[model samples]
Target chain A: MTTTLRTRQRFAKAGVLTGLVIGGLFAALPVLWMLSTSLKSNGEVFQNPPQLITESFSFDAYAEILGNGAQLRFFLNSYIVAFAVTVLTLLVAILAGYAFSRFTFPGQKTINAVIVSVQAVPPITLVIPYFGLVVALGLYNTYPGLILTHMVFTLPYAIIMITAYLNTLPKELDESVKVDGGTSWTALWRILVPISVPGLIAVGVYTFMISWNEYLFALTLTRTDDMRTVPIGIQLLMGQHSYEWNQMMAMSILGSIPVLVLFLLFQRRFIGGLTAGAVKA
Target chain B: MTSTTAPDTTAPTQEPVTPDRPRTTLTRRLSPFGYLSPTIVLIVVLMVIPIVMVISYSFRDNVIVQENSVFAGLANYTTVLTDPNFLAALKNTAIFITVSTVAHLILGLAFAMMLNTQLLGGVTKAIFRIVYILPWLFTIAVIAVIWRLLLDPSGVVNYVLQTLGLLQEGVNWLSDPGKALWAVTFVNIWSGYPFFMISLLAGLQGIPNDLYEAAAVDGANPVQRFLNVTLPQLRPVIISMAVLDLIWTSQQFALIWMLTGGGPLNVTEVLSTFTYKQAFSEYEFATASAAAVIVLLLTMVLAFFYVRLQKER
Candidate 1:
């Protein structure tokens, strides 16, 4: 009986270790493939019985992408839109979140319900009307137009997450500020915002990512190539008759770098924000 | 200080009718709205107004060529509902969402369970968690392109399969009509399961070890303990995640658009892509609006139930 129990324990350990290793490799494979392909020459990409690692590393793809003025414009546009959306969304969400968490006011419940329901609406449903609206307002192909539209999705979730995070903070903190002759605005800015830095960072990163990766709105709203974002830029490469696999992969890698760096820097906060936002919602 | 303390205590008792209350009450009534006004204004202009426009557009015969809208009543809806392509898209959406959601749930739960085990060291588990979530962070457009390259006729996936003696010849993954939907579904599952894993992992960590011990003490085996204790604790998370995944997967556009363009004869066309093609490719704005409204209604219904269910919990 002792022998059987020991053997079973050993078997279970081996089973778990094997599962973890295999799952890790499977999860990492696509990203590895992207990095590998980006480093290969065009010839190397089409080699029969494709290799995971190239024999000779090449920087030609990245060099070519860097040389392309159009691609640089796309990157610049993406950065501008993403940054604007992040700043704007954070400002509005923080104020609204503070109000929702700390104050009792008329129409609070109704507004909260609207915010929740807004998140449920499919983004595709509004594309047609948005296209027309942007054109009507003469904001199509402009940064402000895309930034405003991206906020439609980002603001609701940001507010929800910040509110949830604030709910955990002690009300006594705000009361103390009040006791010190500080108004609500001072309480939010001096005490609450400083304490909620992690939550704010999470919200900012989330908003930036959503705007950076947004495809449909970017595709529809921006008719000019110079106004196109990275996702749309990569998509245009796919639309070309001849496939430039290496260049395409390089562009994809470049586009993903900002997000990957952000994640690596704040993996814990991102995961916390995601789960908290989901659970609370 | 003594006088302040006495007033502070009595303030609550006379909160509604103090001599200074009216001004305080007015500020309290107005301040929250002041904080919320910016967000409210933005959502109203960008989201609510657009949706209202979509509803109006759906009722009219609006097209790109005709600048002026003509009242078409339910003609747009009739056209969209009766179109064979739209019907196929609806069916494909259901199939794709069902398959991908189930795959994510099963695989995600399995991964979460593995990550929860003690066999892996802390560093190793952390590294694996990051690896699993890498795909989820990537833009869908990039993911779609990467998979398109990997699943091409002579792509890496086929090459590996051939080397392992699993495939006799390179199969057309994106181009074959019959296989395209499944291919797109596989990509969706690959990119999405991390979400499920993370949420479920959090759920697993929240479950008390005492429950499992109690089950074991009751003569329950490992499998029995999991089913009796683990699964019951995980039910709410699972339902909420499943419903959220259903709404998301049903409206997935970028992956399908980038990979297949809803092509190889539109076999993989879901509602979002269908609406996109109708508006952009065919310039049928009214019909596209109608189709989008239907998709919106479907997701909203699921979301409503999810919210209600969460409230009950």
Candidate 2:
């Protein structure tokens, strides 16, 4: 009996280890190969036996991407657009979240429902009309066009998350200011916003990530190399270079750095918040 | 006013009228709308108006490009619904989303379970967790690029498979009509599963230790315990994730766009690509608008169920 139990324990351990290794490889090997290829010379990309690490590994691809004015412009546009989207989303969402959490507004449920359902509106649905509107308004191929449209995507999630976060904090935190003859607006800035920094951080990080990674709008709204975000820039690079494999890999890595760094910094908060809808119940 | 369904503990149902201060009551009354104004305006211009415009556009002929657009009634819808390519896109989208969601759920649950094992150290699990989430970290564009390289005819993936006797020759993954849909779907699964894994990992941790202990005392083996306890405990999260995944996976365009361009005789063409081609490539905005509206309505039906499910819980 003891021998059987011991054997079962051994098998379980082996099973777990095997599963972990295979899963780790599945998730990591392609990413690893991308990094390896970025380091390799473009000519070596299709060598009969692909090596994860090449002796010819150097920073040529990275240098090429960083040194180019057009490529660097993609990074700049991404930062400008994503940063604008994050700040604006946070401000708008915070105020809306405040209202949802604090007051019993007349159309609160309806408005909230509208915001929630807004997420279900596929981007493809909006792109056509947006093309008409943006062109009509002469905002086509501009930052304002991209920024405004991306907010439609970012704001709903941010509002829901911030509202959920604020709901966790007792109303008394803000109400105390109101009792002291201060307005709710002042109380929000002074008390609620300050205390809600962590939640706001999580929301801001997510907003930035969404805007940073956004493709469809950025692709449609912008018409120039200087205006294109990194994702679109990567696609352009694929077309322009055709088969400059190392350069393409390098661009992808560079493009991914901001969100990757942000994820690494706040994985726990971001993941916890994202899956809260699933897990909180 | 129906704060009954809010589910947040600290959210009070209504604002208490502090009778002492008229100013406070006034501020409370007016400020909610004031705070909400920006959101309202943005949502109106950006979401509501655009949706209205799209619906209206769907009824017209040559709306965007032509100056004298005509009211075509159901003509645009008929054109879209009758188009064989649109029908192909609809079928492909269903398969793509269903396969992707199921694969995501399975892979997510397995990884979550493995990572949640009691025998492993937290540090070890954390490293593996990072590895597991690596794919989800990259943009869909980067994912598209990386996979394209890997699935290249003479690429490392083929090299490994051929050497392992899995395939006799390098398969042209993206360009091949038979394999294009599955190749793109596989990439979709790869980039998508980490989110489900994260959610499921959190769900797994939330399952109580005492429940498992009780099951063990009741002579339940691991599999039996998992079936009776773990699965039941995780049902809510699983359903929620499944519905959410279905909604998202169906809407996936960027990955399919960047990877295959819905090409090789449109084998990988999904609704989003079909609509995009109609508007941008083919310049048939009215038909694209009809297709887009169909996609929207399909998403809403799924979302309606998701919201209802959440309310039920």
Least accurate stretch of 10 residues (summed lDDT) in model 1 chain B?
B1-10
Relative to the true structure, candidate 1 reaches a TM of: 0.96
lDDT of each: 0.88, 0.90
Off by over 4 Å in 1: A1-6, B1-19, B63-65
Interface CA RMSD of each prediction in angstroms: 4.8, 5.7
Off by over 4 Å in 2: A1-7, A278-281, B1-24
Candidate 2, residues A95-127, lDDT tens digits: the string is 899889887868888999999888878899999
Error of 2 at B193 (Å): 0.3
Among incorrect, acceptable, medium and high, the docking class of model 2 is medium
Worst 10 residues of 1 chain A by lDDT: A177-186
- Candidate 2 residues B142-202, lDDT tens each? 9999999999999988999999999999999999999999999999999999999999999
In model 2 chain A, which range of ten residues has the least summed lDDT?
A272-281
